[model samples]
Target: MIVNQFLVLGALLFSIGVYGVLVRRNAVLVLLSIELMLAAVNINLVAFGAFVDDAAAAGQVFALFVITVAAAEVGIGLAIVVLIFRNRSSANVDELDLMKW
Candidate 1:
């Protein structure tokens, strides 16, 4: 497959992720959308790393870092979601106002 194909796929996936984040009220769904966006970014990174001739392997390394960050994000995000559910009994994004004074 060509780099352009991967780029287009990534763009499509990212767009869907954005739509899910904007339209969904469920915290879990929003987190899943964020994961989708990260996956799209990873796809683009790997595609470019494979197609480019620089041989520095920076793109793959950066992708790995992004994966690590994403894992942490999921862990923290789920913990927050669980806490919210325990306190409020709902995972709806609109209902979360813990930061509001």
Candidate 2:
């Protein structure tokens, strides 16, 4: 029952993140969507770790790794976005076609 609820919540959040990424043209919004997706993944991991109270803490460890990766991604992504904004005068992804070479 609780596991099902957690799965449902994770699924919903993932779907929302996907939708946001697909519908938004701003790079920042896309980054935010990615963060949402990562959050959903973390929720699933933590929930599973809590549900199965075994001696294995692999799920929790994986969640911590995911968090670390997400933080690094956000940092790098923001830096790139800022650079693009400074050069292009806007943060819209549609304007990034100049780099298609």
lDDT, each prediction = 0.94, 0.93
Q: What is the C-alpha lDDT profile of model 1 across 8-59, one tens digit per residue?
A: 9999999999999999999999999999999999999989988884678877
The C-alpha local distance difference test score for the whole of candidate 1 amounts to 0.94
Any runs in candidate 2 off by more than 4 Å, and if so which?
A: 99-101
Model 2 TM-score (2 dp): 0.91
Q: What TM-score, over all chains together, does every model reach?
A: 0.91, 0.91
lDDT of 2 by residue, 39-72 (tens): 9999899889888866878779889999999999
- How many residue pairs collide in each prediction? 0, 0
